[model samples]
Target chain A: MAFLSGLSAFPITPSDRGGHVDTAALKRLVTRLCTAGVDSIGLLGSTGTYMYLSREERRRALSVAIDETGASIPVVVGVGALRTDEAVRLAQDAKASGAAAGLLAAVSYAPLTEDEVFEHFSTVARESGLPIVIYDNPGTTHFRFTANLVERLAHVPGIVAIKNPTEKPEEISSHLAQQRSMTPKGFPIGYSGDWSAAEAMICGADTWYSVLAGILPDVCLRMVRAAQNGDVEEARRLDATLSPIWDLFKQFSSLRTVYTIADLLGVSKAEPPRPILPLPALAKEKVAHCLTLLEQDLA
Target chain B: MAFLSGLSAFPITPSDRGGHVDTAALKRLVTRLCTAGVDSIGLLGSTGTYMYLSREERRRALSVAIDETGASIPVVVGVGALRTDEAVRLAQDAKASGAAAGLLAAVSYAPLTEDEVFEHFSTVARESGLPIVIYDNPGTTHFRFTANLVERLAHVPGIVAIKNPTEKPEEISSHLAQQRSMTPKGFPIGYSGDWSAAEAMICGADTWYSVLAGILPDVCLRMVRAAQNGDVEEARRLDATLSPIWDLFKQFSSLRTVYTIADLLGVSKAEPPRPILPLPALAKEKVAHCLTLLEQDLA
Candidate 1:
């Protein structure tokens, strides 16, 4: 549970166009997160293209990540799939492979009811026995988790935490407080939208399930650490300096932008799976310019 | 292209919990569509739980449907998948199995761009050599096809038709006209939402890609025939008679409601794939009552 609270860096699962995992490249990314001392490693998350990869590829990515972390950093694997049975198998794979927990999203194509989603979460938790972190990513899954649903799922045994989509900066406090009041005491509430995550953390969020942290953990760590240490000004300053990057993320989605970032920084040159083309050259150039400006501003 | 017109019956691909295709049940459903004289069979569609089934199961379903139809009715199989390569492969499977065409939706996890979708559709059509129908079911795929995008895709070779979600009764005429004007001449534009499809057909849309017709093809065919024969009074009257069923579809999605109808009518007893639980007892009772009312009215 403690591992669920802090900068849980969500790294992409590098793969070829066929969705075969690049284990060597994945291990490199995990090692970078470990080396930078991210509080936990969020492996195979949305940013990891978890929904796009095959079960074998997902397992391969997790194995490489778990091997790289080596008990030093807790690794939470994304176990979402369109089928309940498939999700259970993925969670079981994560559990048997030594993952810390399984992040389960209500990945739907049928536009499920609340009761269906409840049963899905309960069944996955019961069957897999892997602790669950409710992954509320409406942008991809298209199923938004109500605060009421989150509160209900919180009480389900083996369901430990939630990764909420962050609200705007002005609403983070009330959103965090309402979630706190609704759920059990000590239930970790994390936020993901990278642009607003720092404010969420500063407003006392438990974790930042970050895409930005996946590629550039060092700066993310500094901001998270500053927030954790109660240095509000320092955290805000770091966030302000990274505004250009956030703008790029907002404009061209974090997943696409991060892929470009990983390539630009010589971390990994893997293109996202097809149907999600690499950022066009113009967008890549814009991302590159942001990185240069970020380096100068941080310096 | 002619096969894409008139009443297209979309039957559920009955499958067990493990995602194995219930080939017998599925063949029975396809046989029913053919016997009812539907123009085409929309196999493995959203109502068919296409996204929930595995690749092997999808292939099995398509094979069974194609075999059952036996060149009598064109089978437009759903070939949608999250990845482009996988979609292309599914389209290839459909083509190899003698499916008439592939139904491709912009099934997304990364929340694709218009360009990405354009590329996805173009690639699937070009690579598979199977005629493609743009399955624009935004309710499930969460990717809306802009009129402009549809206009663009219409010109792509081998991309033949579109199955659009119906608009409100008052808007159906203009909506149909707008789509007709935007796309190239002779591009088939069909409507799917069952309640509104009668109105769309009367408004001169090319097809009614119907879920209700999958089970009760006779009633739907009568309506389509009435609209085609310029009997507006008869078509509207038939639409009014089926209003109860439409109410149920609106409340509990066409997919879930149709599953219960399939079971209640003894066409298929297979439950939908898991994570999409069957309707609760009360909903089932309501469906049964509606069927009783429908039988008396039709008689």
Candidate 2:
């Protein structure tokens, strides 16, 4: 299997009360993820609050993850930014930190054309030594990459993998078709939508970039392993077990809900960046109930 | 009436073939809007491609617009950014550039909370010497300001007005109701959804911050004037005449369509920044037909 395949844990970069990244907590979390027998780890992802942190904070977060992981598994750092120059700078920093790959989203406040999206990635790819995983999260970027655009980006050197967020099942299938027909053989594609991971995996995604894996590495890994073994029944059973949590993700942003769950599970004290508050009281009750069910099922 | 009242023209920031801001063309456009009798001119709006331009480029664009207008009308500069410090810097620059007011959207790649929204504007309001118009453009920002949040922002000393983009009539009515109950009376609410301006005005908006006003200032002003004079029938008649163009705006982004129309009218050679292409060929034909129909109506 490729380094990018399997359950890659996107760990939260926990912060201090003063809103600064807590390097000690981050290191501890990375250590946990690395030893948890997951395939890889991703730092500075949306779950990592990459956009909300300062560049220096992001660098420190990546460096801590890399230093602690230290070749145990590949580390991918999110280098998405508002401008090409800023993204290039972050990608360079990630490369210097010895990250194996840089994850980039064509983030723009203004709407971007397909050509502009191609240029943004090509520029970052040219500047960075690490391989790039195109992060296609249109819900946040508001810049949707058409299958045609993704096919065009696949031709860019260093863009070796893709992490697609949830869309309709047909949309995912179309993207898979594009990847199959347009890209070279074995260009690993992963699914980031936790709720739809089993369906995506069944549709031939090479990996599951699992947010649930951040805390429940074992549980998430079991689901991916089932899919890998072609046990569709078992995969569906595992996904059904986690459907309650996924339902919560659909109601509120995963970033906010995950922080609340992490707190409940005694995993991390990580909170989402200010302006993105933790789940409200009602949502928290639902999350607690779901977590209880998850724990009960595992028990 | 306040400086923000009546029709505010959001002029496009003209750019040359090489994608540099055409300051000379921008100045001429500003001059035309000012002389055409717009109540105010909003430079560097979303229509101004504010996010695509560099800070220095944005500053130059604002300087040219302010210089060209020369106090004949208020020049509201869009000072929104992804980072709070960057937004503060833009607001400071807008103040230094002799702009009459600063227009700010809570632009973010990460979703922001109500408290974060309030903090962002309060910080900018403290630093900016000019009056501030809180731009509630959730479509672009992905950060919706709750009615409670807007009521809170209204209490900020320099946040003198609100320019709400188009939402459902019920949403607009609810927001207006909240404003009426929460803020001090006559807090200068305005509408930016050009297609919905007459309807928003009838619901008690104080002005229209219009993209159409950039090209057809007279027609936009006539609609606003009709609403102001309690002539809903006349306003609906005028709006119906422009429904063909409004339908085009609905089909594609107003930004791309406006650039094409501006080109057809010999106003400016301004194009959307790279990645936001010009109107496709079929859309161009539709736009041309709409323009022809509009010309005959005006004649």
Top-lDDT candidate index = 1
User: Of the native A-B interface contacts, what share survives in model 1?
Assistant: 0.93
Model 2, span B196-227: residue lDDT tens: 88788877778889998887788888888898
- List model 2 lDDT by residue over A110-197, tens digit each: 6677777898899889977668999998878988888788888888889989898885655777767777787778888888889888
Candidate 1 docking DockQ: 0.92
TM-score (chain B only), all candidates: 0.98, 0.96
Q: Highest DockQ: which candidate?
A: 1
- Alpha carbon deviation, residue A156, candidate 1 (Å): 0.5
Quote the lDDT for A190 in model 2. 88
The candidate 1 chain B region of ten consecutive residues with least summed lDDT is B1-10
| Per-model lDDT | 0.92, 0.83
Give the RMSD in angstroms, all C-alphas superposed, for model 1. Answer: 1.0
Best by TM-score: 1
Docking class of 2: acceptable
Q: State the iRMSD of every prediction, in order shown.
A: 0.6, 3.6
